[model samples]
Target: MTLKQALNRTREIFVANNIADARLESELLLRHTLNISQTQLYIDINQELSPEQEKAFWHLVKRRLNGEPTVYITGHREFYGLDFYVDPNVLIPRPESELLVEKALKLAQHQPGVTIAEIGTGCGAIAISLALNLPQAKIYATDISAPALKVARANCQKHGVLNRVRLLLGDMLDSLPQPVDLIVANLPYVKESELLAQFPVSSEPRLALNGGPDGLERIRQLCRQLNGKLRPEGYLLLEIGQGQETAVTTFLSNLLPSAEIEVTPDLSGIDRVVSLHLT
Candidate 1:
């Protein structure tokens, strides 16, 4: 079959399986299988797929039909405009989390040699992006899962930020050195009961998704640990789940009573990130 025929077939299968963005997903799979650029794919649309290429394409299609994420199938995902390796060991990087990176960069812009700590830095997406953007800043990233830290460390090295991003394997803030100028986290905020219902992807790490009953447990724990870990006048940027602003705000306020707190929404206008300035 030709490239055009294969893409058409793949899209039909994806659509029939109720997959949203079927066409885009099919195109991405085809591109990955063929090891071709988008331009090359378009230019070579009529090129016939060798038997080997067809076999590989169908393999990926089956995985997608089975609900495996495309990023995992592709082994890489783009975050903050940088491509990073991904696998079932870590949660796939979502675009919404980029808001945390944006807020952190803004806070670090004027502060030279700022020290930043990232809690649960899966795949090192946020920390590596910050390291690339804020060249003068020192970054420390921690993940409780050793496998997740391995992926993060690999990504840090891939992005050439390994020297700047210190990877640690421990619970949030527990492994980080004290007195960091800024702390950013995108911890698991999905409530335990909501996990299967909200995110049915079995391939994603449960340790990166379950946040207890109200979905604020991990955030609360991090707040409790922030008192001395964050330097005075430092900032804490957290990416939270929808409808979590009130509870997170209350918790952080109670923990750091004099801290300045604000909520920043994602592109969809959902309350997504909570930014706090320590007193």
Candidate 2:
């Protein structure tokens, strides 16, 4: 069938299934199937698609309709203006999370050559972006799953920062060799009860999202373990879920009430990052 015909049919299917961003989804699927860019799609609107290509496009559409994330289907995502490979093994890099990287970049400006560690590196987007932007910084990244670490390693190489970012396989701070100048984490902070009720858990890895009973389990653990893992004058920049700011900050206060804590919001104005500078 012609590209135009295939695109129209795919749009209909997506709309009928109530898929979000149906038109954009159809365009991306068509682009992937035809191995062309959006501009090329218009140029080749009349070109015909092979049967194999048609089959592949339909498969992707079916997966999307089944609630699978488009990023996972495409095996790629763009974050902080850099492209990274993604899959079911890792949480898709998100725009909101870019704020965390931005905050880190600004903080790194004054502390060049500082050692940094990223807990739950997943696709290594944060660590790699920091290493790329902060050329003098050394970063260590960790993920509990080996598959996730493999993807992160490839991404580190893709960004040409493999030499600066070390990928490890373990949970939290256990994988790090020593306390770092900064500890940046986007670890799971979602509560157990809210996992199924609010977010798209079907396509994401659960271990990467579940934050235990109160959702502060990992963060609390990180705070306690961080004393031994962080430099005396260093700090921790963490990404927290919506409504988690007060809880996390309050918990941190209970641990180190004398510490300076600040909450920074993302572009959407949600309290997304918790910045803790040691006193």
Candidate 3:
């Protein structure tokens, strides 16, 4: 089968199953299967696929039809224009989390020696992205799951930030050796009650998505720990779920009554990122 034929077939199958972004996912899976770049894929769009290649491509499509995420099949995800190694071990990095990186970059600007901590670093996409952008900054990437840290460590090395982004094994702020000038987290904000019902996300490690009854459990605990782990006047940027703005902001406000709290929306205008500037 030609590359174009394979791509079309995959897209058709994905669309029939009601998968969102069917065309994009089809191209991504095809590129991954052939280990080719998008540019090359298009350049050879009419090239015939070897029997083995065609079989391998169909196998991945089958996995996707069975509810496995395409990123897991590809074992790669892109965040903030950087490629990350991902698997079932860590939550796949989401584009919405890029807001956290952007805000942190601006906050850490001109402060070459600034210290930053990323709670629940998952695949280390956020920490490594910041480290690469702010080479002089001290960055700590922490996760409670040992296996998740392994994935983060690999990405740190892949991005050549091994010497810069420290991978620590601990929960939230507990692993930070010292208070940081900036704390950014995309902690699991999915309500525990809703976790099991969320597909694709349900395939991710429960440790990375469970946030107790209200989906603010982890966010709340991180807020409570800001006293010692966050320096005076430091900034905290958190990615939250829809309808969580009031609860998360109220919690942060009551905890640090004098701090400045702000919520930023994603492209969809959802209240996705909550920012707090400590006084």
Candidate 2 lDDT over residue span 132-233, tens digit each = 888888899988889999999999888898888988888788888988889999988889888888675477888888899988888888888877888877
TM-score of each: 0.98, 0.95, 0.97
- The model with the greatest TM-score is 1
lDDT of 3 by residue, 1-279 (tens): 999999898888888999999999999999999999999999999999999999999999999988899999999899999899999999989888898999899989889899999999999999999999998999999999999999999999999989999899987788789999999999988898887687443588888888899999999999888888899989999999989999998888888899999999999999999999988
* Candidate 3 backbone clash number: 0
Candidate achieving higher TM-score, 1 or 2: 1
Question: What is the C-alpha local distance difference test score of each model?
Answer: 0.92, 0.87, 0.92
Q: Local error of candidate 2 at 116, Å?
A: 0.9
Residue 252, candidate 3: Cα error in Å is 1.3
Give the Å shift of residue 263 in candidate 1: 0.5
lDDT of 1: 0.92
Q: How far is candidate 3 from the true structure (C-alpha RMSD, Å)?
A: 1.2
Residue 40, model 2: lDDT of: 99
- Where is model 3 more than 4 Å wrong at Cα? none
